[model samples]
Target: MEYSEKKALAIKEYFAGGTTSTKLGLKYGFGNASVSRWVAMEKKKKRKFEEYAASIRAVREGMPTDVKALQEELRMARLNISLLEAMIDISDDQHGTDIRKKAGTRRS
Candidate 1:
């Protein structure tokens, strides 16, 4: 019934993913506008925790060194990069008709 308890419950409901924040807030008696703030705060908390974990892992591991392991990691990284680039190209092709047209004009 307390405000913090209501906010905590709203946050949990929002992160569970299927439920909209408005529905969660209404169910939990929080104002609709506060739902967006609550979701943003939850995202920031998650991001901070992830960054902290990565820093801790980096300090503990001191980085990888084996040549084979390094090569495999590099290969995976390149594959991921290529996949991301392809996705960007597809997005640009789908949504950038004006920009593409201008670039084609300049090339002529």
Candidate 2:
């Protein structure tokens, strides 16, 4: 992983637990003071992410159920789910066919 990604993951792990910055720095191979900076940067990124997510939720939740916006979202979700199910079914069918072919080949 890149240094930034590693640092971000470390910061996330630290915040999700009760670990100290010093301990995190030692474990993550960063300077003790760098841990504080990384944590702050991660917090800013998280705040921005949360804000964007909240806005999206608001747009979805505030829409009337009968409105086109809501209908479109529902339609999209249903389509996506259908596509995923179809893909899974195809994969399972292929796997089963392969297994049956292998079994027949072994018997012969």
lDDT of 2 by residue, 1-108 (tens): 789887877888889888888888888788879988878877899899999999999988877655977789999999999998788778879786432244435543
As for candidate 1, its clashing pairs are: none
Candidate 1 lDDT tens digits, 1-108: 898888888888788789887788789887777987978988999999999999999866765546668899999999999998788778888987433244435544
**TM-score of each predicted structure versus truth:** 0.54, 0.48
Please, what is the whole-model Cα lDDT of each candidate in the order they appear? 0.82, 0.82
10 residues in a row with least lDDT, candidate 2: 97-106
Candidate 1 RMSD to the real structure? 21.3
Assess the local accuracy of residue 63 in candidate 2 as a C-alpha lDDT between 0 and 100: 75
**Model 1 lDDT-worst window of ten:** 98-107
